[model samples]
Target: MNGIIGKKVGMTSIFDDAGRNVACTVVEAGPCVVTQVKTDDTDQYNSLQLAYGDKKEKSSTKQLVGHFSAAGTGPKSDVVEFRDMNLTKALGETVTVDEVFTEGDKIAAVGTSKGKGFQGVVKRHNFRGVNDATHGQHNRQRAPGSIGAASYPARVFKGMRMAGRDGGGRVTVKNLRVLKVFPERNLILVKGAIPGPKGGTVILHK
Candidate 1:
């Protein structure tokens, strides 16, 4: 498959071959179960749907439980599809990290960024606020200034970059180099940081 589901296991620094201390984010990649296969004739596209993480049987719906039953596995928590992933595995076959990725290979990581709820333009949009703290600029230092004109187009623009909500959005970080892969431990280390908080789910795609 072209991708695998993983959990962010946090970050660490490892010494590379050049003896440089390389920082990397640890990801607990899956030995994911192939739950379903889509074909061009059947679904009008070719893709593989995989399931990851364990879910309590009682917590799952009967339909999902029966779906897992067909795959010969218990209820799963996460289900994701990777398009154009060429695979001919059966419904219950497993795919591990080592099979798809190798060290030094550049890949992409996708995840939801950590949420920084309602924020201002300074922090959210990186707007330099006023640039000076002179006179009576108390709480107005970080305020977004001059949003709209006075009369003509009096309304604020539709796609204004003003702050409302920040982060907790799906982010894709590409060109991250794979530093290490431990298939036995179901873990892979990638250069630099990935999105989301600790234990958050991520997808590593080639």
Candidate 2:
């Protein structure tokens, strides 16, 4: 597996080979430092922990500072681990976009989706609600109609889709093609949209 840490720069449309415009998401990947290397003999797993972006020491805890210090790097904003990487890198080594991914390679993007805060069934769960205000249906357009039964099994079931907080959860968008890669700028344009807002950290794996 090959992966790198990146930030979502936003989305743009580019013309493809056949003169057709294609929508792609711009991501600023790597130059991520390997903070830790876990081995099966000690940690019981094989993975490389990579850190990207910069963080202030004043805002970071002592333990985190020491952790990054072992790698000979300053505090980083995003730290992620990957198993079975394509390369064997030592602590403090940098991982760039071209090393892990290339144009036309299929990859998966993992990140947290944009948080919509508290939401209603009409918007969150796509409930039709009361679409019309006909038969004394005042203010019922966005209301969730019924939630429970009359008797036996009177309580609402668990895992029942209802009005509540939405998004701000881990999301994985797979089978996305790598449209382009700019090594000098450390940018990768992946075909189609990925989760999260601009400047949010994203993980791309192939």
Candidate 3:
């Protein structure tokens, strides 16, 4: 997918052309610099590696410094690649939200969901616990009930759904329409809620 690495600037509402209020997520999409470009002849594939954000030179590792040095740019806080881009050039370039996308363009936003630590079966997997509270089930309110048929396999199945960790996983919201694009600020206002918290890194794909 052709896209930009951005930070979620939170969400707000804006009026459309017809004066209808539209809920949108504001993202600080790149003014991303082209750090490296892979070609079919050399790397056996085509891709453009983009670098964004700023990092302190003193704190950067040698490998990262080498990578940034190869780009002729200082060390960046983040780096991501857009594979098979439609550009003819190689490196030392910039791509903003305005260049590849515009208002009404269908897009997909990918981000990591908020972490919800060790949860119960009801909350994590939406499993219905013991429904009858009055039927001598004093301690069965949040219980997962019998895990399986007794002694059938003499052990819990490997793939059986149970309570554990939830959330904090990769999530993608697809077919999101771009409500507006601010070229000067390199911002993108996309329709609807995106995964992850405010100021979180998100990949906007088209």
Ranking of predictions according to lDDT: 2, 1, 3
Task: List, residue by residue over 77-180, the lDDT tens digit for candidate 1.
Answer: 99999888855677899989998898999999999999999999999999888756777677777889888988878798888889799999999999999999
lDDT (10s digit) by residue, model 2, range 3-118: 99999999999999999999999999998999999888979978899999999999899999999999999999999899988788998999999999989999999999999999
Error of 3 at 111 (Å): 0.7
The residue-level lDDT of candidate 2 at 102 comes to 83
Cand. 2 TM to true fold: 0.93
Lowest lDDT block of 10, candidate 2: 126-135
List the candidate 3 regions with Cα displacement exceeding 4 Å: none
TM-score of each: 0.93, 0.93, 0.93
| Residue 150 lDDT (model 1) | 83
Clash pairs (backbone) in predicted model 2: none
Question: Residue 47: error of model 1 in Å?
Answer: 1.7
Question: Superposing every Cα of model 1 onto the true structure, what RMSD results?
Answer: 1.6
RMSD of each: 1.6, 1.6, 1.6
lDDT of 1: 0.92
Most accurate candidate by lDDT: 2
The residue-by-residue lDDT of candidate 3 on 1-206, one tens digit each, is 68899999999999998999999999999988899888889899999888888889998999999888887889998788888876655578788788879888999999999999999989988888888889898988887877877767788888778889999999999999998899998899999999999988899988
- Select the stronger candidate by lDDT from 2 and 3: 2
